[model samples]
Target: MASSDLTRKPTIRDVAAVAGLSHGTVSRVINGGHWVSPEARAAVEEAIRTTGYTTNHAARSLATGRSGSLAFLLTESQQLLFSDPTFALLLRGATAALAERAMTLVLLIADSPGEQANVERYVRAGHVDGVLLVSSHASDSLLASLVAAQVPTVCSGIPRAGDTPVPSVSIDEVGSARMMTRYLMDRGHRRIALITGPNDTPGGRFRLVGFREELGDRFDPGLVEQGPYERDSGNAAMTRLLERAPDIDAVFAASDVMAVGAIDALRR
Candidate 1:
């Protein structure tokens, strides 16, 4: 080969030729190996390593009608999302999952109306194959717009009222809260206080309802405090609960950050 040819980037055809397989076989292996033989898969992988060939994602997307990209949409303000460890953990997990599937994740921060409009337009244009929405508030209109646009979407939590039915992955917030409250009550914590998330969110509303149901008649109005799911809010709510119900024996906070803040307040 000439020096110029030797330095050129390798392609799928080159990988197939090096692996002693058809281009179709190599393509199958690259696109998740649905019907390719084990021996063929091994050969293609070895050839890929030997040739240092990277997939031409744009070409593949053109052929397959898939962008191989997903969006992680955060509806909360950028400051709040960055301040919370939960968002960080979610982003890490989503990135790892998409990497395994040979896809990329696009982080979309749609905190303001203009940002939300731009994001909706991007999704409508099919920039990504799907979306993983998080931190959605009840008043958020983007969810409805995405649903109406027929863009594939999955939420990290249950959708609040007015959102169309979208697939989701979430814990049973109400059940878990009830379980926690029941455990405390069983342990003789009759004067239990509750720190709740914003009432507009499904998690916050359901958790508060669970706490009340578990506490029955013992659920005192004075012991209930509402706040954002942050350490400072937790601290403030705990402090207020303690002042109003000094005899309170235990507290149930809606989130881990809030729980830590409640502990801090207890310490002080």
Candidate 2:
């Protein structure tokens, strides 16, 4: 193929010719499909870099059943995820797992209902091999959409009780919440308060359930509060909890970012 025919991006064929290898050999190297001689792989890599070659995902998908690409769906803003330590940790873990599989990650930003519909459309279009969703709310329409798609999907955090099962890998949220709450109980805190994430989110609901399970029903009901999984929201929630229950001796904020805000409120 002529180089002029190349549009905005170079393809594996370009790299293959430059590397003096067959297109199949170049593809094998690119996909990590099989082991190639070091010299041959080196030549392909050099050519790839020189030509600025990228994979033709559509063609590859047609030839092979697998796309070798993973989609990560985020229902939050980049700013929120970057600032939240919990999201960062999850990102690190997901990145490591995908790297181990030699897969490429395509991040989909779906913070709103409209954006979520777009995600569904893309998935239905066979744009990716699999999907990983990190939802902030339980009973979300997006989760329902994903479940209906019947794609091999993995939920990054706890999932709400939904219609279908989506394979998931998550920290033992309820157990962790119990551990955190028990710590406060051990510290001679009687009237403790909790600032939980939204009740509709799996992480939020599970953590809140764990907290309540550990604290029991004897504590004043006013001490419990709900807020967004964010710093400012945590601060405001903590303030509200204090206003309602001034005797609250200890506070448990759902996320570390929220914890920071709770601590700030206490200090002030």
On TM-score, the candidate that comes out on top is 1
- Expressed as tens digits, the lDDT of each residue in 1-268 for candidate 1 is 2357568989898899899999999999998859888999999999999888998888988988889999999987787677788999999999999999878999999988999999999999888999999978887899998888889999999887766788988889889999999999889878888998999888889999899888888878888889888889999999988887788888888888888889999999
Best by lDDT: 1
Q: If scored against the real structure, what TM-score would every candidate get?
A: 0.89, 0.79
lDDT of 2 by residue, 165-225 (tens): 7787888889999999899899888787878888878778888878888888655558877
lDDT of 1 at 139: 77
Itemize residue pairs with steric clashes in candidate 1: none
- Can you tell me which runs of candidate 2 are displaced by over 4 Å? 1-58
Task: For each candidate in turn, give its C-alpha RMSD to the true structure in angstroms.
Answer: 2.2, 3.9
Residue-level error in angstroms, candidate 2, position 25: 6.3
Please give the CA lDDT of all the candidate structures.
Answer: 0.89, 0.80
Once superposed on the true structure, which residue ranges of model 1 sit more than 4 Å away at CA? none
Please, what's the RMSD in Å of model 1?
2.2
